[model samples]
Target: MHDTKVTTDVMNPDCIVIGYNEIDFAEHARRKRAEKGKSGGYHDLLTNSVLLGGERRTYMDLLNIVRERTTGCPSRLSAFELPSLGVAYLTSFLRRRGFSAAPVNSFNSATEQLREMLAGSPRAVAITTTYYVYDEPIQQIVRFVREQNPDVPIIVGGPRIQNLCSDQSPESRDGRLRPLGADIYINSTQGEDTLAAVLAALRDKGGDLSRTPNLIYRDPAAPDGPMLHTLTTVENNDLDENAVDWSYFDPSYYAPTAYMRTSRSCSFGCAFCNYPALAGPLNLSDLSTIEKELRYLCDHGVRNLIFVDDTFNVPLPRFKKICRMMIENKFDLKWISFFRCSNADDEAFDLMAEAGCTAVFLGIESGDQRILKNMTKFAKTDRYEYGIRELTRRGIATLASIIVGFPGETEESVKNTVAFLNRTQPTFYNVMLYYHDVLAPIENQREKYGIVGSGYAWRHSTMSWQEATDWKDYLVRNVNGPALMPGYGLSLWTLPYLLANGMTMEETVEFIKGASRLVIKGLDTDYLDPEPEIEEILRGLAAVRDGAGQGASS
Candidate 1:
């Protein structure tokens, strides 16, 4: 379905928000990916060799691994895919403030009608960014906006443009701003109020940006251009306190799935991730607020729901209560969400199943106990295994999300992971390589781990970036299950469409196994057909990895 919901105040929207550089899998891209699926074994290896640099690995080492049919290599086609929830969250808030907000989805999507929208003279344009991967597309979008409507104020936010830069000196931060040319660089995670205020002020034209809070902006009077302006840092402790209006987009315009979060921020301070720092602290929504939201979505014909909470089952008692509410209310919805192995209890899983939880994505970061410890997962590998086994037994499909290539990762640690995967064998597996974040928990103790550098481009004590990537490739092939390539994994927006339409986990695995290509669009989450619940997609991947490892040994 095309996104053609023309807003009433479209010509002069209080704000026109744009999200750019998303991987748009059209008919042609899918057809091309399907064709590459034909090459099978050679294609997998070649993809890995081409995508992963040959730094630490010798030419022969690379050649040998390629010959063995590595399972997890994300052919050169792999890239980062950001969740679209950010823009939705911002727009919902803007509307709550009684300001008109329209979304321009991507650079391509926006470029098509941006000039037309610009003609409408939006009070301001806000663009939310995610990973650094979107920098190129963001630059283009910003340049185009400036050229088309130079006077219209531009506001930018999201993880990629937050606190880390907010703390830097003006020249340093301006260095980043010089490329994008955004009028206002919003850098805090407590965005709802911050963004709404900016749009409200922009609507009044003479409002002081410096008075708004936690921003790096071009002061019109400043010589070097942008300067940091800090008001009280926004700390909206009440997670579910505000009214988040999701009425901006038509329900049918998106994929069948409707995603919600009962909480904001994560309490667990995993060293490798920067989310906790951004989110501030773990906080939950009042059950009443949740019921209201869920009932609203259901009333609007959104039955396939997913919670995008970093840890859906945390604050165990609250999660259980919500489940009961869903059951008692007879909420006609089937759902999927992320869960932590430590929090997966018998009652929780039972309530989830009864509440129509067909699937869960668990962050099973590593199989090695030491690696798990280093990652601060806290829970033992056995706990992870138990959670997986329990979920599967309850007829709940599980996708264990793994991140390989931590600072201290090694061959033996990966072997431990392989064994863990073989034992648990999740319905599907998603493996992503560890990337560096100087502001994350890992960077806090960089010297302890011998980490040096800004981004994932760092010097670790024991493992080179190349070596870490090699191990990641090893895990994907070694981990038993239908391992999804990086940036191409399933997303909340599409998960419900797949499940509600009868795309069983088994069929998804087989489709993945048979294709054997670098799938960026993720196993066609849009298409669906009925099949059995259980299958061995990971089994084949594990076998290939095992045979390859054995061949190399001999």
Candidate 2:
């Protein structure tokens, strides 16, 4: 650790903010293949198969398209999109306070960038570290800032940190979650206030941090202990579209549409979800204000937008009003958002599609209703199927996110999920492994329910008011695997049943193939949908089979 005594005046004059995007291991692996004159890696093969009906595209064509879209900034453009959303939000927030904040994608060279940025100005650096790939680089940047300019404060925050600080108990701590690192840990959902206070502290403006809420920092003298400040609650106001400084963003890096946070809390309290605890209850934005924001995005040439709400479909009337406004105003932009499957219906689905909704993501959680109820999801199986079918029939793409492992999960339940997927025929399906946290806040309740902790919880699990921690590593490496004896037998039994229902044998093969690709490529399978084109190819195969059968008969 570097010293923290150097003043910002003596150091660099500007405040530099660095956000990390992990090293593109997939790109590196692809280069290795090319050097050896080999064909595509897993990601390339998977994407090509899914998007292009398994037809191969030249590497040069792929590279050119990426270059055109990203403006030659970085080859790992897709990975940067999500991080860019956070950076964009923070960038606007920081600028509102009259501070200069630059969003840098501190790949592997974060330390060098920090050093250079600090050389010219007495600067403070803020970085968001998420997942394991970011750990070393962020630590390096923080250490360098402390060593080179000790007074320059380095602060870190993100979902990873919020999860790590959650409760960890023996019963709850399974090896599934990853921990986060940071000097000041702010676990509040409203990060703008905490971020503002940090900037004020750096400037010696001496703001009342007690009102800032969600600010957690270490007293420099005491390394092990952290001090938590009382959080401030801000009322939702109708924000003017012109209030945000959009000019600071690089057009190439920013998504075409802006992400707006319409609410701060969630209504449904799912056990696996940390949203309710982090964001608190749902506080909605004024429908008129939301309409204005949507108009602004469309005016700025954004053809697509995404709502970052924890549950965009909650408050059914409010959602309908927003939809009516979009339709009435003739807003032509397509959008997607997350929704709880249990809360949606045919009427809601029709209204959303009428308002240019292209897609909606559903957190289906599990195929087993018992698992759903156990997780406090409160999702009804019949309603979920109805909602899915209604949305699909209306030409609205439905993406189902399913979690595989839960405390009461058996192998039979997993097969039930596969069977459910076959029946739904959702446009996209995402399978997530169950994560276990060592010290979860809900540990005591585990005994109350007579349920033993899986020794793992998500980052949102806490003990005694601690924040959530991520357990991705443990979940992937330990909790998830092929089914065991009883489960395997159930899987065997369910395979034919699924095919008999609606899922073709080819689709089942594709699902397994896609899962294997994820393990090999470390790429998300959610975005891959090679099914439509693959279906056409399969039809041709069936035709050929029928022709051969006719010939044999003759």
Give per-candidate clash totals.
Answer: 5, 51
Local accuracy of candidate 2 as per-residue lDDT tens digits, 381-473: 777788888887888766667665565666566666766767777666544555443333344456544443342222222221011111221
Model 1 over residues 1-554: C-alpha lDDT tens digits? Answer: 32334344677888887765543333223343454433222222222221212121111232223323334453221111122565666666777668887766445544666788897678898887754443555676788888888888888877777744745776777787667777887777766678887876676757577678767777777736447566758658355656455556776533356557788888798888878877777878889999998887787777677788888788888889999999999986888888887986898878998999988888888889999889888888888988999888999877777766687888888788878888888776656656676767787778898876654445577776666556666666555455442233233234565555544454444544433232321222333221111123344445655666798899
After aligning candidate 1 to the native by TM-score, how far in Å is the CA of 507 from where it should be? 2.8
For the record, the alpha-carbon RMSD of candidate 1 to the native fold, in angstroms, is 10.0
| TM-score of each prediction | 0.79, 0.65
For model 1, what is the alpha-carbon lDDT of residue 304? 78
Please give the distance, in angstroms, between residue 213's alpha carbon in candidate 2 and its true position after superposition.
6.7
lDDT of 2: 0.52
Candidate 1 lDDT trough over 10 residues, lowest sum: 50-59
Q: Evaluate model 1: give its lDDT.
A: 0.64
Return the TM-score for candidate 2, rounded to 2 decimals. 0.65
